[model samples]
Target: MADFLGSVWWMIVSLGVLVTFHEFGHFWVARRCGVKVLRFSVGFGRPLWTRRDRHGTEFVVALLPLGGYVRMLDEREGNVHPAERAHAFNNKPVWQRIAIVAAGPVANVILCLALLWAMFMVGRADYSATLGPVQGMAASANLHPGDRITDVDGRPVQSWAEASIALTLAAMDRRDARVDVLGPEGDDRHATLPLGQLPAGFAEQRVPELAGLSWGFQQRQAIVAEVSTGSPADGVLMPGDRILAVDGQSVDSADQVEPLIAALGRRGGPGMVEVQREEDRLALELTPRQDASAPGGWRVGVAMSAGTAPAYDVRAQYGPLAAVPAAIREAGRMTADTLGMMKRLVTGNASLKNVSGPVGIARAANASAKRGVDWFLYFLAALSLGLAILNFLPIPILDGGHLLYYLIELVKGSPLSDRVMIAGQYVGLALLAGLMGLAFYNDILGQLPR
Candidate 1:
């Protein structure tokens, strides 16, 4: 329930901030272009709070929080007084109209950059881009376990998050990349990975795993997380107890305890199980039970630690002035990646599953928020970039669509006929509806058990 509430709260916060900033760009530009602002609203539906400025523009914070819009006095939308005709949005010069229409996406891009700057200054904590197991493509490329990736295609990377994006993009483009790594023996090695050779159904696998890479062999302490009721382990072992050994054999990780306990069950004798229980370490006599349902044909009836995201092994922080270049570079990289993803979609090289809806956004927002402010800012930056790119696609009823109209008007010295414009709006609505439907479908599929 807390998670659900957190997801809801963060989703609202994320959307509200993005939407308000986007609309403000249009409002600010429109007003500068001499258009009469009517209502400036964040969200839709019933207004929660509203104030009218001296200029009669009503500013509102509404209930929905999903999206917002800036309404301007336009001759086409409503009858404008003849005295106010010069202030109508439709009366603006073609270039001014283009600027006003383009401002929304431009604002989001700025916001992306700003968020990234803040993230870098605050420092992003993450695990190293180290390989645990290597096979298939990674193996063919001569990569090995414990090899720490440092550079890909000339770009240096410090974390799995950055390396994964670079690698995923390479795979999508079917391009081979020169990779630099620090091997297990502390030797520097370089290899060309055949990212192009990934199978067509690679989308079904996590990018790293699809490319035959594991973050690292994460070792989990053999602390019992749960014990089944009325089972042998229920009384013999309790949650939070760390198993030290089974049948007199030492076991340190959760993965190591299973085999030893199963061996004891097969031997048909009681064994001394050593466990660390808070302040005490003791040997207790216990016998494992045979159960077909258990792995290895024996049962301990206790769940071990399943592992978790590793704590930050490194920090990517810099001074405010120093973060400028890094932030700009990140912004440029994000833009390129977003564009690349769209190209993959158009070329059918990517699955519709890659497209996510609000459900996915909510999950990401909640998860990032839990990580810390820096991580959340990073997430917001990426989401902002995506929003900017999406709004700039040359489709009708969007900012880019509006800019398209103005560009045609500029070339022909006349506006498109109302009939033609209406038809375009209809086409745009259909296209948007279909796109949104696909996103929702993907979101639902993601929730279903794999």
Candidate 2:
């Protein structure tokens, strides 16, 4: 129950900040455009706390945190005093009105940029784009483990995060991407990865495990760091023992030893293993045991220490001036990726399973908060970008919908008919309801047993 409450608290705090940032943009712009702002509210329904400023603008914190609004004095809504008529929102120039309406989403983008700037300044651990042994379809490309990926489709990538995004984009487009890698033996080579073979809607998955194109930082040496008690490795393996081979197969790296051990364990027999300890080669016989967590899989219950792991924290901090452009580029990339995802969803190229509702978001908020402040900020940046883009989608009952009506008014020199506007509102509500229903369904489905 405490954990559940903590999750709810974080979710509310995060959402509340974003919502306030969004609504403040509208309120500020509306006031600047000589419009009389009636109320600036965070959330909806009955106000939990309300106060009117000297300017007669009511500031409110409402009961529901689902959404918020900035209510401006408009002549169309009610009668305006003759003195205040000139300051009404509808009486303002169309350009000014457009600015006021567009400010909310634009504020979200700006907030995202600021958050990303702070993230880059703080720095995070980044792994080199090194391949950790090829498997499955990737082996067909003749790419070997320990190869450092330098670029994808001529675009340079310095880290695994960058490579993953670039590769995912290429896969989504069904393009055969040209990947260049520098091998361990001082040789550079290029391979064409057929990303089209990926399953449909695969890109929609966060951190999709691509079938062919896979890479990771160099693995630590297969030296035992810990031996689980009462398991297969309890008596047979000891910490600091460097595993040299299993079943006469030479193991050069840590990544190769996992499958080798699992294979031997599955055979349900004792296996001869070679290890090097203190400059002496030792032969040991040990039977592997099945791991309960991984059914049909076997394990020796040993953990490997990270060798040279500190070498991968490639932090590239930027000055205030430089961070601005970097932040813009990062925000733009995330925005484009989100737009691509929405496009795929609408076109049926992506599955509804990708949709996340409030519950999933709350869980994510809780998880990110536990990771650290930097990660929590990263989550906020991404979420802000998503909210900005989603709010701009051309649907009624959204900011984009209001902008659409305004645009039509601009082109036709008159407001849309009241009856037509009402119909659009109803249609928009229905569409939003359906989307929310689907999002909630997916969220609940994710919690059920697989």
lDDT against the true structure, each candidate: 0.87, 0.82
Please, what is the TM-score per model? 0.83, 0.83
Report the Cα lDDT for residue 100, model 1.
93
Model 1 / residue 96 / CA error / Å: 1.2
Report the poorest 10 consecutive residues by lDDT, candidate 2: 204-213
Q: Which residue pairs collide, candidate 2?
A: none
lDDT of 1 by residue, 317-420 (tens): 99999999999998998888788788888898777778889888999999999999999999999988888888998789988888888889999999999998
Name the 10 consecutive residues with the lowest summed lDDT in model 1: 198-207
**Candidate 2 overall lDDT versus native:** 0.82
Tens digits of lDDT, candidate 2, 152-244: 898788788788877776776777778899999989999877777776656444422564445554456788889889877788888999999
Candidate 2 global TM-score: 0.83
RMSD of each: 4.6, 4.5
Which pairs of residues collide in candidate 1?
none
lDDT of 2 at 194: 78
